[model samples]
Target: MKTSILRWLLDPLTSLLALWLWSRDRGRRPYDAVWRLARVTRHPDELLYRVHGHRPDDPGDALP
Candidate 1:
């Protein structure tokens, strides 16, 4: 319960900070920032590839 509350409060701040860094670095795409942030915050098994039905061994499953 406390963990969930902390996550809810912190996740947006973390994302904003990540995006600010990415922008300062002149990253090519905003989605890249989001993807990078997700990699740190989310479980590998719960990543976009799984939601999109990509197999673990599929070439498309590779991270950017």
Candidate 2:
């Protein structure tokens, strides 16, 4: 119930933000930036691991 309500409130805001980003990047498809943002937002830890090349068990991973 809580998750659903959060999604309901954020979905429209996400769409509008995506549309704004799409307008800024004219060379890319409308969905490109949104999709990338969605993927990162969905799995930020995975993105951080890939970017920093650190194992999940590393001490630095616990900073935040």
Candidate 3:
């Protein structure tokens, strides 16, 4: 249910918001947000590891 809503609704809104933010902020672009999302989704553990001060490259850091 959550994924469906995000895919169908939130993604578009996020894109639009990114675009709007990009237009107002010269330092950042809309594509940056999309790129970050892609990276995080591809490695879901990355964000968690970063927050917990764990190194992703460490074998012991990997979640089973």
Residues 1-64 of candidate 1 have per-residue lDDT tens digits of: 6743554466766556556667776786554445455545555655555334224567776866
TM-score of 3: 0.32
lDDT of each: 0.55, 0.55, 0.51
Q: If scored against the real structure, what TM-score would every candidate get?
A: 0.33, 0.36, 0.32
**Total clashing pairs for each candidate:** 0, 0, 0
List the candidate 1 regions with Cα displacement exceeding 4 Å: 1-10, 33-57, 60-64
> The CA-based lDDT of model 1 is what?
0.55
Global fold similarity of model 2 (TM-score): 0.36
| Better by TM-score, candidate 3 or 2 | 2
Q: Considering TM-score, which of the candidate structures 1 and 2 is the better prediction for this target?
A: 2
For candidate 3, write residues 1-64 as lDDT tens digits: 7643554374665455545555667646445554344435555666653233234668776878
| lDDT score, candidate 1, position 46 | 51
